[model samples]
Target: MPGMVGRVPTSAAAVPGARSAHGTASAILGHPWGGTALGPPDSWDPAVRAVVDLVLSSPVPMALAYGDQLVLLYNDGYAELIGDRHPAAIGRPAAEVFVDVWHLPGVGDVLERTYRQGESVLEKEAVLPVDRRDGHAAEQATFTRGHSPVRDSAGRVVGVLTVAAQTTQVTNHLESLSDFAAALAGTLTLDDVARVALRYALDAFDADRVAFAVDDPGGWRTVRRVRGELLDEADERLPPLWRRVSGDSTAPLAVTARSGVPIFTPDGQPMREHAVDRHDQKVRALASVPLRSAVVRGGLAVGYHQAHPWSAAERALLSASAELVGQATERARRFETQHGTAQLLQRSMLPEHLPDLPRLRIAARYDPGVDGNAAGGDFYDAFLLPTGGLGVVLGDVAGHDVQAAARMGQVRAALRALALADPRPDAVLTGLDRLVASLGAEAGTHELFVTVVFGVIDADRRSITLASAGHPAPLLRRSAPGQPRAEYLDLPTGAPLGLGCRPRTATMAFAPGDTLLLFSDGVVERRQQSLSVGLARLADVVAEATSGDPRALCAVATAAVAGATEDDVAVLAVEYAVRPSRSAAMEMPAEPTAPSRVRHWMTEQLTEWQVPETIVGAAVLCTSELTTNALLHAGTAARVEIDLSAERLLVSVSDSGTRGTVTRAQTDTLSSRGRGLGLIEQLSDAWGTDPTVRGSTVWFEILLPAG
Candidate 1:
């Protein structure tokens, strides 16, 4: 350990008494190789003797391959280097000894160059396949080997002398550090960094304990270890002896902290009192390395319950590894601070209030492509326009990031303001296009653009007029309960905003119980399928709706392709219906008690509507039956709405369950249920059940006789 690994000499074997006072290779001196092709040990030439003398007594791993056949000779250190192949390879030919590594690129070539050309060669980080092999174990080892020529007294090359140092420990250290850095790259807390560092270091070193301790809020905390196992960080406690050591400047941790060097106690004598996991047991070895950093100064400690040969190389590695823990801790602290600010900024840009309107139901959702949305471009909003119409807008600005998100916020805010002021679908879109074009016209701007489907629904006219600015067509669910399947509004659309183009209005009838689905491309676009396939899939979902509940419809449509997207998805589903106002509606929890609450609500609503007493009980009975079926069959949050008008009085129950069918159940007098639908049919002027994308709604309209 004290002497340097000396350079190779020009000759060996010719010297008398090539003594091997060693640990491992001493057995080679009396080996059975004297009867082999390498010849008798006493007959070796002077050049071979000189090199063998140089290697036999050396402290480091060294080997010499002499003569034209390159027979192998190694020292005690090199015997351990060959693993299980030591004594057998003492005087074997080099080619046979290196059979596994001979074919590797430049493996034997480097030695050949030194032996033939009389030049010296140095190879750092060389990988060789020659550790051990007795049919059970063989491992790859990394080495830094030096190859130099061995020549006779006349200066003619006689052999090749090689010096090798196994670098697998250093390689493992660097690899473990790389893994630790990757694990902590996204960490936003000190606890996460500390846990990863301690656990990974303990595993990498195969030690009993590994810890990073600092003077913190409570006390010095170390990652606890017991029987070669690491303690969970959540349940970790301060080491029982650490409090005593923290006050002593002569402690290993304190000494390393002040000196910035690794302090090692290979023998257990000095550490017996401070060792063990709160058990007062003795440890075989212990080490503490200082962490010098620009953030906070700390130290990394490692301990072993078994005797381990501590080396300077290992101490140097531990010192460098401690610095990485400091870097990760600082990085996590910075990330947490930056991420919080980004969330506040994003929330401030989106809509907080959605208009509550009668004769219309709206549901909108926005998801960022990335967590915390450093920047995302998808946006949606629902608001009351100035012209007494409901305006629903959904759009996606091109690109992603804080810059794109900022541009999206600007465009979204501007679109909402313009729509609330005008309400004409075409007029608002035209204004938005001009605004985007003008914003980009400013010199040296990257032409930012947006695609949008802006629409206004007028309950009075029972129509929804839409303008698509190079966006996907809105799916229109115009089919009545028993009519044909729903279809998309296949209207001619125009260019996106900032393209210096105008868009024309595309209007379609939005009847009572009809729905219009607006969404960003992220919903219907996928890497595995074409846009047309996604469009067809969307069409199928929309075509299945037979009710006008916005939330239910949104659930069904989004469920088809929710978590499979890479881009952020924004959906705005608007269903045109006589959605009762607060005064005309009452919502209760969907449970066993819902039927009674709903019956009571029906009694109150009918009284307010001044319905003739003769039919009030029948209406209440029908409402109870429908509400019970919705809660039991759909397992959805249910709502019942009653709208009383001059033409007819409408009572409807809707739920959010996406599966199940509305069927006419045959019943006898013995049954407790199944009579509700029959009663609804017998009692009302017109009653029908419509099954929407997510769930079904059953409504009965009693025509009011002309006065």
Candidate 2:
């Protein structure tokens, strides 16, 4: 290939810096194509030399890629286009320098066509993301390239010449526009979308602060600030934050809202001398753009804490950010309005509060699904049935939005009405299914469906009857008094509501220390596992915990799958208490004088049990001190329970009405206030606070003198 170029270049053409002004490219031309298949520059063809001369003289970005491999050759303009891979890129393979372009969707095909077939190619406004560096710094740059063939003096096409310019700035703005539009679609509130836009604007313009505010009749109200220190304009010495603009501008926020113009307040302005401005004096540059929405009108402000030279591109980006804020604000307003109406509809259909059953503790919790602002169909209810039975139901209508929530309300109300008429569990669900089937037919709803489980707990009969309609099974956990074992009660299943099927009921008898848990599918259904797996996890958690408190049981079950569930959740549970035959409990009023009455009541109960005289006085003292503390701190000596056995005398004072913990206080000489918990510790052989499903009971056991 060295002699293939028969004629050699003249001495004037071979001079080092004669052909180009760029030092690196000119030096490489002296020993050009080093180690490459092409020969030295002096033995180069005349046509290649002429093209290289034109490239070096032109200011635009251009490259001469010779031979089939497209070995790289460039001018000063091309070196700047190559970013950090400039100097080493000379005389190297063109594929290595333009490697990122090869990764583009169809760019490699275009280049191969020009190289193999000698076809010219031209493009306009095409998106080609190219990495300007060989390193991991992915500066995503887009470009428009012009490609044509370079021929020898004999007119035979040999290589391709490529002309390209970077369009990263324009592509970046378009990308931000698309990203901001997508974020605004699923947002739940104005604050949600405002935060999203603020984050994008801050990163895009490299500004320190972003805000969306309104100049309402009262004062300036800030919706949010993404970053930087924000001042609270509540001081009497300061004017409103919206009015403290640069120079003599009055209410620049209002002016921007009226004129739809962006206002800038650069650093060292004249009228930034007010106390309001001093609070934020570190603010070096400020730009306010107007935001207009159908529901609200406001202004957006982007600020920098250090000196900044405002550019037209930055101003345009700020305006675009404000537009996103407005559109998102309007959507949030509509969603909030719909969400409020749906919430009211759902709450009105469900019970205001669960009934308080005697000897049975009950607790229920409901949480909307993870989808923002869209109501779900999950519903739960625990009401007193007509025949001294409790009607507990958990239902799920299949959808999300106002329609699903409304259907849930309707089904819940119908279940209540049916149960009140006939307290049978099967009858309640059968009637509900029939009612839903009829309603679905009337509404022409082909997809209308509801999964429900209705249960009746008869305390008088000590029996529970539950019937399901394609719903999650209820769990029944049983443990003996002072034992720590639990299980699940498997109930029969049938078709969901609106699916016509003959349904059957399941009944089981239970005693004290047994718990019944009814919940919606959202409680045990996770995206990653099967429903049965989730149910087994629930059983394991219930077995490991040793509390009969329904709230504690629900808390553990919900926490086990806290972030895993993706639907609305509801949990309802009831636990029967193990009442002791030898214990007597009395409810006492919460008053300053209630302690004396409780102490007398406890003394009489101990005397009736023939408690020894030596410990009866101490037991009475312990009861008096605990009762007095409960009344003083918790606002109530809610209940006092006294139990007597052959060896121990147990007395408990419950202050379940309030939520302050009983703590052991330090000893003080003058003030006798902080020593009650410590003294209670001293008087009893063993003492602990027992938290129940509803409240807590502080109990103490005293060892009776040897009887």
- Give the best candidate by TM-score: 2
**Candidate 1: tens digits of C-alpha lDDT, residues 599-704:** 8878977887678776688888888877766654454567788766443566878776622222112111112234566667678766555433334567776655
Clashing pairs in 2: 476-489
Model 1: per-residue Cα lDDT at residue 38 = 48
Off by over 4 Å in 2: 1-140, 143-166, 214-221, 226-255, 266-280, 292-295, 356-361, 367-378, 384-390, 396-452, 458-463, 468-471, 477-488, 494-515, 521-569, 575-707
Per-residue error at 537 for model 2, in Å? 6.0
User: Which 10 consecutive residues of model 1 have the lowest summed lDDT?
Assistant: 1-10
| Tens-digit lDDT track of model 2 for 527-574 | 878877888888888777645556556656675554556687777888
Query: How many steric overlaps does candidate 2 have?
Result: 1
